[model samples]
Target: MQPFWNFPATAGGTINSINNAGIETFRGNELDSLTREICQNSLDAVKDEEQPVIVEFKQFQISRNQFPQRDELVNAFNKCESTWKSKNTKIEQFVEQAKYILKNDQIPFLRISDFNTKGLEGARTGELGTPWSSLVREAGSSNKGDSSGGSFGIGKSAPFANSKLRTLFYSSYDITDYQSHIGVANIMSFEERPGFNTLGTGYFTDSHNSTAISNLLNLDPSFQRDETGTDIYVTAFEPKENWVEAIRNSVIYNFFITIWQDKLVVKIEDETISHENIGTLISKLDDDKEEYCQVKAYFKLLTSEEGIQVPYPAKRYKKIGEFKEGEATLYIMKGEDLNRRVLMTRKAGMRLFEQNRISGSISFTGILIIHGTHMNQVFKKMENPAHTEWEPNRYEEAPSEAKKAFSDLRKFIRETVQQQFQAETTETMDAFGVSDFLPDTTQVAGEGDEKKESLTMKIKSIAHKKKEKPKKKVKKKQQKENFEDTLEEVGITPEGDQAGHSNDDRNEGEGLGGGTGNQQGEQGPADEGTGGAKEGKGEKEKNKPIDVDTRYICLEKDSGLYRLNIKPEKKFEKGKLEFKVSGEQSDYILPVITVTSNDIEITSIDKNVVRFVNLTGKKPKNIQVQVDYEQYCVLEVDLYEI
Candidate 1:
C-alpha cells in the first residue's frame, strides 16, 4: 500500500454513479460559493485574536507534467470511460472533460493560501476530529467547534467543484508544527481490471491510511507554505476573467462585518481588503452588479456614530446552547432611503441574513450583532452550511429551544424598533411579518370601558372649541401647523395620555383637532395654518392652508409586485404616482412593470411612474404595482383633482 492515488475496490459491492452531490452543491455556485466557503473555513481557524487572519487568492499556471501521479489519474479516467461506454451517460461526458485537461501542454491552477491563522490542525495525530481529517476524510460531519463559521464539512468540495478535472490538493502546516499535503479526486467510479470495481473517491497520500504526504508537495514554483498556514491548489482550474473581482465581491458580501472589525483580511490578486480600506473598497463596488447590494449601506451603519446602539439582554430570551445572561447589541440608523432591513450577525462577524420581520414606517437600516459566546453558539447551530440564513429547525439538540430562542430574538428586536425608531403609527407598517404584533382595532371595547382612540387609528379632523372674540389676540401663541406629510409625522402618545385627554389645544397628537390657543405637546406643538399664525376672524380664516396627510401602506403581491393601500384626504379627486425605486445615492430607478387598480382606470407612464385619471373622494384605493426589483419600495406619489 504505497502512497499513491488509491480508490479502494468497492468491497461493499455497491454500484456507484458519477454524481457527487457535495461537489455539485458547490459546482453551480462558481467562485461565489468557493470564496464564501474557503474564507469561512479560514476565518474559523483564526490562531490569534489580536491580528486578522489573511486569505489570499491567486491563479498560477504550470507544466502538465508537474501534476504528481498524473498518469494514474488519467488511467483511472480511461477505466471509468470503458466501464460506462455505449450508453453515453454522464460518466462518458465527465471522462471526456477529464481527458481534455491532460491533452493541454500547460495546466491552469488556482492556489489559495491563508496566513495569520491556525492552519489545518492535527495532521499527524491520525485523529477523527482533526481539521485535516474533516476536510479530506470526513464528508457529512464537521470538526468545527461551537463558535466556528461552518457546521457541515461539505464545503471541502468547493475547490474540487472549481477544477475542470474535478481534482484538488490540500497542504497545511498547523500551529502544532505538523505539516502534511494530500490530493483528492472526485471522479466517476471506475474499473481497475476486467471485473474489479472501485469507489468513486480516491486520495493521493504517502501511506495506506489516506493521510497526506508529509512535507513533499510544491505543485507550483510560486506556492510555498513557509508560515503556519494552509495552501490549496485547485488543479486543472479554468476560471472566468473577472474571477478576482468576483471573489472579492463575495468576501465583502458575506464577511463585511468580520473585515470591518479587523478580525479577517482578504487579498484577491493585487487588492488587499483590511479594516482601514473597507470603506474605500465598498465605495467602488457597483451596487447594481453585486449580490450584496446593501453592503455599502450596511458598512456605513456599522461605522457611523449617529445610530442608536441598544444593549439587549439575552437572559430574557429562552435558553440557546448554554444560555448565557450576556447581552447583544442592536444598531438602529435612520435615513430617508435605507429601505428598512436589519442584518443579523453572530460574534464571528458573518452576517446570517436580513431580519425584515420587524415592522415600522420609518426608513432605517440596522445591524443586530450577537457577541455573547452562548448566543453565538446558538446562532451557529442554527445556520446552514453557507451561513446565509439561520433556521432554528436546523438546531438538532432541542427543537423547542431553537424556536423559543428565535421567537425571543424577534420579540426583543421588534419591541425595541417599535418603541424607538417608529415615528407615527404602525398603520403604514411597510415591513412584512409584524402584522401579528399589532393590536386588532376591529375588536370592540369591553362593556365598562369607553372606546377611546387606538394609537393605530387614523386621526380625523376635530372641531376646534369656538373662542369668544379670541380675546383680541391676547399674547400670540406658538405651535406647529398641521404637520404636512413627511417621514416624521408624530410621536406615539403614552397610553395614559389617551385617557382623559382633551380635544382642545392640549391635544398632543395634533389629530386634526382644531387649536384655538397655544398648547404644548411632548413631541412639540400642534398648531393652525401657515407657521402657527392665529386664525383671523371673518373671511381671513378662509385663507388657511388645507393640511393634507398622504400616507400609503405597501403589501407584497408576489416577488416584484407591491400593492399600495392609500386614502385620499377627501379634498383631492384624482392623482398620479411617481414610483422611484429605493437605491444608493437616491438613484430612484425602479423598473415598474404594470400598475393597475381593480376599480380605478390606471396606466403606466414610464419605467418609474403611473397615472390614474379617476378617483372617488376619501375612498381607500388599492393599486397593484409590479416592479422589477425585489420588495417594498419608497415611492413618490402625486395626487391631483380630475
Candidate 2:
C-alpha cells in the first residue's frame, strides 16, 4: 500500500511564498483572470496535429471512499486541524471545511479538464523543461518557449487559490508515452506535524521516494476519463452562487478572440461556449453596461478594419532608427466604455496591461495589439510578477538595442494617438459649426513646402492688433439702422425691422382709410385686403419678391435618418416659394418631410424643388426636415419667389 502523503522538507515556505507572490495581479475580475489563465495554458499545450483545444469545467459530488488513500487523507486532515493554532478566520474556516468534507460520505469537487492537446509530458524526476517537473516540482521556472503564453509557471497557483482546501489532483495521459499519470497535491497553510520536516506540501502516490504518479489505484475508474489530455480535480471546491454564469461570462469576454479564431473550444458542463452563440450569452448580461459595450465593440472592431495601424521600429542588429516594420492595431473607441488607458496585448491574444500611460480623455477606450516576431522577447523581460505592466526602470536602463526599440515604439504610439485626437477634435468642431465663428486652423495644402509663421506668432500678432484698435461709442438708433442695412446687403430682411423701419412706422398707414382712396367708388385688385393699400415703404418692400440661397442648408445623418436644417439667406412675404435642391444623385432617396409646424404648408413636390407656402403670409421660419436614406448626402437649397 502507498503512504497516505509524502511531504517534502527541502522546499520549506514555498507554499506561502508562491501563494502570496502577486496572485492579486489581476485587479479587474477574478473569474476573468482564471478563465484567461486556464485557456492560455491549454492553448500553449496544443499538439502539433493542428487540432483545436477543448477545455471543460464540471462540478460533481464524490464520496470520500472514491479517493485511493481515503483513510490516510482523513487522518491527515484531522491531525492538521488539531495542531493548527492560527487565529485567522479564513484559515480556520478552510480547516473546518476540509475536515467536514473528509468526514462526510459525499463531497463536492470541481473538475477542469483540457483535451486535443499534448498533455503534461516529459520526465517526472529529471531536470527542468519537462511538464511534470516544471508544474509539480519547480516554482518560477521558465519551461515555456517563446511562443507559449505562460513563462513564470506560477499560473498553476490559480487553481490552488480557488480551491478551499488548496488541494487538487492532476491526471494526464500522453499519447507519445502510452501511459497515464495521476497525482494529488495539497498545499496547506499550517504545518502537518511537529519535528516531521513537513513543509505543508504532500502528494498521494504508492511510492514514497518517487514524485511521479503512475495510477490512482482504486480511484482510477471514477477519476480517469478518455485516452489523452489533463483533468484537474479540485477537492472541497468553493463555488459562489451562480458560479456557472460567472464562468460563462468570463470565458466569453476574455477568450472570445481565441474562440472566434476557432483555435479553442470552451464548455461548462453541457453548455458549449463558442463565438457563434456568444452574442446570446452576452444578452443575458446587462447590455447597457460599459463592459458589455466594450466587449461588443472589441469584437466588431476586430473583425473589420475599423482602427488605425501604428508602425514601430523593429531592428535586426541593434541599429537606432533602422525600422524593420512591425505594426499594432489601435482601436479608439467613443465614450467612456472602458478605462482611459491603452490595453496592450501580444500575439497570444491575452491582454497584458489594462492601464498603460496613454494619457487622453476619459471618453476614449482603446485596445492596442502589438504584432511582430521579436515583441515576445522584448515584453517577456519587461513583464512584472503580476504580469500587469512593463517595468519602467528596465526600459530606462536596458541595453541600447532594447532601449531604442522600446523608446521608438512608445514614441510612435503616443504620437499616433495624439494625431488621432487632434483629427477627431477637429471633426467634432466642424460638425458643430465652430469654424464659422473662429479662424480656420486647417493647414493649407502645399504650405509645408513654404516658410510660414508659427501659429503662436500669428495669434500674438492678432492680439496686439486688437489691443491697439480704438473703441467707439454709437447711438442706439444708429446701431439699429446699421444692423438693418447690413441685413439688407446680405439679402436677409430683419424680422422686427424692415429696411431701417420700425414696427410702428410700418403699421402707420394701415387702417387710415376704410378703402382705397379712389375718387369713384371702384374695387381695386380683388386679392387686396380690406384695409386698402398702405403705400408705405414696408408695404412696397413686402410686395417685392425675395430670393434665398439654399446652399447654407445643412444635412445631418442620425440613426438611419437625415435631419435637414434649412437656413434661408433671405425671407419673403406671401408668394410662390421654390426650394431647389442641388447636388442630388441618381441613387439618392428623397426623404418625406413631415411638417412639424402649422405655419408652413406644402404646395407641390417636384424632383428637386419642394414648393411650400407660408400660411402666416410672412417670411417662413427655419424648416426641420427628416428623411430615411441608404446613403448620407448633402443637398444645397436654392429658394426662389415666383
Candidate 3:
C-alpha cells in the first residue's frame, strides 16, 4: 500500500510521527473544527456553475466483513510491535484498542459527501496544482486560486482526529476523466520490528501498485453513481450520540453566510437545512432566544439592501504607483442580545475574524464585505493557515506589490471599522441620554448670574401686577444684589443658582401668573392696603426655601426604552413641593410622545409632576415610571429635591 508518512529514520529512532500534529490547531469543540474545515474544502472544490454546492452528512454501521481490505489491515496490526522500542504506553494501548475494535462485527462510521463540484483530480505526483496528489500525499500543501475559500490543506486531519481508530477513507470521482479513485489512511504510533518496521501511517491499497484499490465499486455502491464529487468515511467515529445535532449547529454557525448567499446547501439525514428554513433549525438547535433573534436579524440585513457603503483605495494595475477606488457594504446592529463582533468576508463568501471581540458592551454585530478585484486579493493574502484571522505580518513578509497593497487594505479596514464602532457607540449613547448622566461643571459667571437676577425680577413684577394697584419699580442693580445676597445666605452661591435651578423656576418665570394676567381697575384705601400686603407676600413666595438634593440616576443602556427611577433623599408633606424634572422632550424636537398621560397635571406643557399612587396601602421608598418617546430620541428625567 502507498504510505505517505514514509520518512526515513536511523536505528532506535522514530520512522515518522503519525500523531495528530495539525489537529491541535483547532481550539474549540471537535465538531466546530470538522464543520468549518470540511465545508471550506468543499467550497474550494466548486466548479464554475450557477448551482450551489450540496453537502450531506450521514451515519451508518458496518460489519468487519463489509470493511474493504479488512484482512490486510488486520494482518498489518498483528505484525506491528505492540509497544515501540522506546516503550511508549499510548502506542501500545492504541494498537490493542484498534485490534479489539476491528475484531468486532459492528463498527460506526460517519460519511460526509459533497455533490455538484469538481472532484480531486490530477496527476499523482503531489504537484502544486494536482488535487489528487495534494489530498493524499501532502500535509499542508495548497494551490487554491485567489478566490478559493481554503488555502491550508492541513484541515484534512480534523476528521481523523474525530475517529477513535484514527482512520478515514477518501473516495472521489474525477469529472475530467470520468474515473473513480479510493484510498484509506490509518494513523498509528511509532513501532519497530524485524524486517516489517515502517511508519505508523499507511494506505489501504495494493502493495505492488500504490494507486490501486481492491474492488472499489463493491465497497460502496454509491461510488458508481456517475457523479463528480467526493465522499469521506470516518471509521470508529467517537462520541456517536448526538453527533448529528452538533454537526448541524456547527455548520449553521460558521457557514450561514454561505447559505445566505445561495452558494451552499447542507443536509443531515432526511432533513434539508438552508437559509430559507433556518428559523426551524435554530429552534431545533436549542439556541438562546436572544441569539436566535440576533441571527434572524443578521440574515435579514444581509439579504436586504439596508447597509452603509464604505469606500477605500485599492491598487489598480501592475504599475509601481497607482490606485483605484473600491467599496464595501457595512451593516451594524446595536443591542445586548447580539454578539459583539465584526465579521470580515470576501467575494468567495468565506468569513474571517470569527474570534475577535470588539471593545464595547454595546454589542455591535455586523459584517463588512470588501468588494473589487484588488481589495479581495489583498484580504485573501492576509489569511493564515487556520483561516480564522488576517495577520499583519503578511505585509512585512510578502513581496513589494502585495506588501503595499495588503498594508493599505489592512489599515483601511482597521480605520473604517474603528470609525464605524465609535460612531455607533456615540449614537447609542445619545439615544440613551448617556451624556446627561455626567456632572454639569460649567461655571456660572457674568451672563448667567445676570440672567438669574433678571428672571427673579420679572417674576416679582408679574406677581405685583396681579394685585389691584401697580407697585413702585425697584432698581435693577439693587434687585440683582439683593437676589445674589439672598442666594448666598441660603447656602446657595449665585453660580449655584445658575447651575442647579430647577425647571419649576424657569417655567414659572416664563409663564408669569400661571397664564392668568391681572385686570386693570381702581380700588379704595382698604383694598389698596390689602393689595400692598399681598404683593409683599408674593415677593416672599417667589424666593421660597427650596431644599435641593440631587442624585444621579442610572438607566439600562442595553435597550432603546428607559424607565425613569426616582430616589428622594428627604421625606415630604402631602402639599410640599415633591420634585421638578428637567430634560423632558420639547415640542420642537419632533415630540416623541404620541399619546400623553391621562393626568393633565403631570403631562402639562409648562411644568409636570410625576405623582405616585399607592395601590397596596403602603408607601414605596422609590418609584419607577415609563416614558414613551420616539425610537431615535433620548429621554432623561432629572428629579430635583424639593
Candidate 4:
C-alpha cells in the first residue's frame, strides 16, 4: 500500500501574514548553569579517580518541519511595512525548534542506561552527586559535591546564549570499587508560557560495560576510561565563532581550583598541566612587605636545554597592592607543598602568537618565601568564589555584581598570566634552559649553618674525654747514629748535628732562657732549638698571590646574548653614546665607543670608534670583535676571549 501526501492550505498563497512567534532575548546565566554541571562532573571524577579525565560531546539533529528558504524570508521581511505588520519567521522558528529539541530530544537521550553507565556509581559505592554539591568530602560538609562555582542553579541554561540546539554530555568515571558513567542531556528553547528562556533535562543514563556502551564510544582510545577516571561527552558541540578558546580556558581555569588541591592528575589531551601551588603565591611574615609588594618583573627561561641562574627572592604571602609603576597588584600563594607549588603571574602585552595582549594561565610557584599558606589564586576566575560563581541576578542586570567581580578578577589574573606567558616566550626566544627560569625565592640565611652548629654541639656532647698525660721520651746513642745514616742516604747533610740531631741542634742557637744555649747543657730551655717559626713562614708562602680574575662570562651570559650595532659619522667627546639616522638605512657603521670606571672594562673594542661596554663592569683582559651584516646591523664583542 502507498501513502498519500497532504498539502498545506497556504501552499499556493503569498503567506504575507506569518508572524514571528519565538523568543528574541538571550542570557548568559543559562550557559553558566550548563558550565556548572559540566565542571561538577569533572571535579568529581578527578577527585575520585586518576589523571586524563575524558569528556564526550554528542550532537543530535532536531527533527522539525522544514522552514522557509532565504528568498521566502527576504520576501516576508520586505512585505512588512511596520512593527505590527513585520514578520520574523526564520528567527522565530529557529528558537521554537531549539526549545523543542531541548525538551523532547536532549532530555530523553541522556537517560539511556547505555549512555550513563554504572561504572561511576558502583566505583563510588553509590556516592554519586546531583547538581548542587562540592567535590570535597570533609568532616562537617558533604563529600558529594558543592554548587559554589555553579551556585546560581542557572548553569544548566547557560548554553542557550551560544546556540539553540540539542546539547548532550556523557562522562565515564573510574573508581576503586567499579568504574562508572554519567550522562547529561538538555534542550535549549524559548518557553511560550512566560516568554522566557529555559533548559529542560532531556535524559540520563548509567550502567556497567556492555555491547550497548561500546557503541557509544566517541572519544579517542587514549581518552577511553581504561583506568579510574571520567569522560565528559557533549554531542552537537555548537561552539560560537570566537568562543572556543574562551570556553576551553574557562573550563580548565575552573577545574584547577575545584580539583587541583586533591592531587589529581589533569590533562587536556596528552599534555599534562597543573595548577600553581597556593604556598608559592603568598609572602612570609618576616619578609620585607615593601619589597614583597613591589611588582617583580623578569623574563622566564624556556626550553629544556637552556639554563638560567635565577636570583629572584622567593616570597611567602599574597601581595594585593601595586608597589611600582606599570605593574598591577600581584598575589602569591603556595597552592600545595614545596615541590608541588608553582609561581604564577598575569601580564599584559602583545606578541607574535597573540594578536592582542594574550591572557590565560601560567605556572609560577616553587619558591622559598612561600613556605606556608596553601591557597593560591593565579588564573582568572579560577579562584575567588565571588567571581567564578554564578548568581541568579547576574543574568538580569547589565553590570551585575557577580560580573563586576569576574571582571576585576579577570584583570588581576590576566596580568599574571601575561607575565608568565611573556617569560616563557622570552625564554623560548633566548633559548635558555629550564633550570634558570626558577622564580626568585627568598632564602633563610644561616639556615644550614644553624643546622650544622646543632649537629656539632650534639657531637661534642656525645664525645669522650681525652687521655691523661704524655710519657717522657728517651734518647739513645744508637738511635742518633741511625737517624744520621738515614739522612745521609736521602742526600741531606748530616749537618754537624742537623741530621738525627739533639735538642741543642734543633734549637739552632736560640736562647730558651735569658742566656743563649749551647749544643750541650740541656740546650737551655729546648725552645731555642726548635724551628717552628720558620715552618710557619714557609706555610704562609704556600698561599702566596696567583694572577687570576674571579669574574668571567660563560654560557649564562651567552644565553641572552644580543648585539646592537651603532655607528657614528663623527666621534664625540666623552659623553653618553647617542646617534641619529635618516633615509634608506642600508649599511651599519660601528659607533664610537667610550668607557668610564663605572662601565665594565671591555677586553676589546672595534678600531672604527666602536667599542662594546659590559654594563656588569666585569673587566676582561682580551676581546673578540664580530660584525653580522645580514642582521641589518649587529656589532658583537666577544667578552669571553678578552
- Say which candidate scores most in lDDT: 1
Q: Report the C-alpha lDDT of model 1 over 116-192, residue by residue, as the tens digit.
A: 87877777865888887788788687988777778888888888889888888888888888788888888867778
* Alpha-carbon RMSD, each predicted model: 16.4, 20.8, 18.2, 27.9
Residue range 411-473, candidate 3, lDDT tens digits: 554455456644332333335786697655565775554334222333444333554545533
Please report, in order, the local distance difference test score of every candidate based on alpha carbons. Answer: 0.69, 0.54, 0.53, 0.28
Number of the predicted model whose TM-score against the real structure is largest: 1
Candidate 2 lDDT over residue span 586-623, tens digit each:
11124344434455666644333344666554443545
- How far off is residue 48 in model 1, in Å? 0.8
Local lDDT at 327 for model 3: 47
Deviation (Å) of 455 in candidate 3: 8.5
Task: Please give the TM-score that candidate 2 achieves against the real structure.
Answer: 0.59
Model 1: residue 604 alpha-carbon error in angstroms: 21
Return whichever of 2 and 4 wins on lDDT. Answer: 2
The alpha-carbon lDDT assigned to residue 382 of candidate 4 equals: 35
Clash pairs for candidate 2: 550-637
Better of 2 and 4 by TM-score: 2
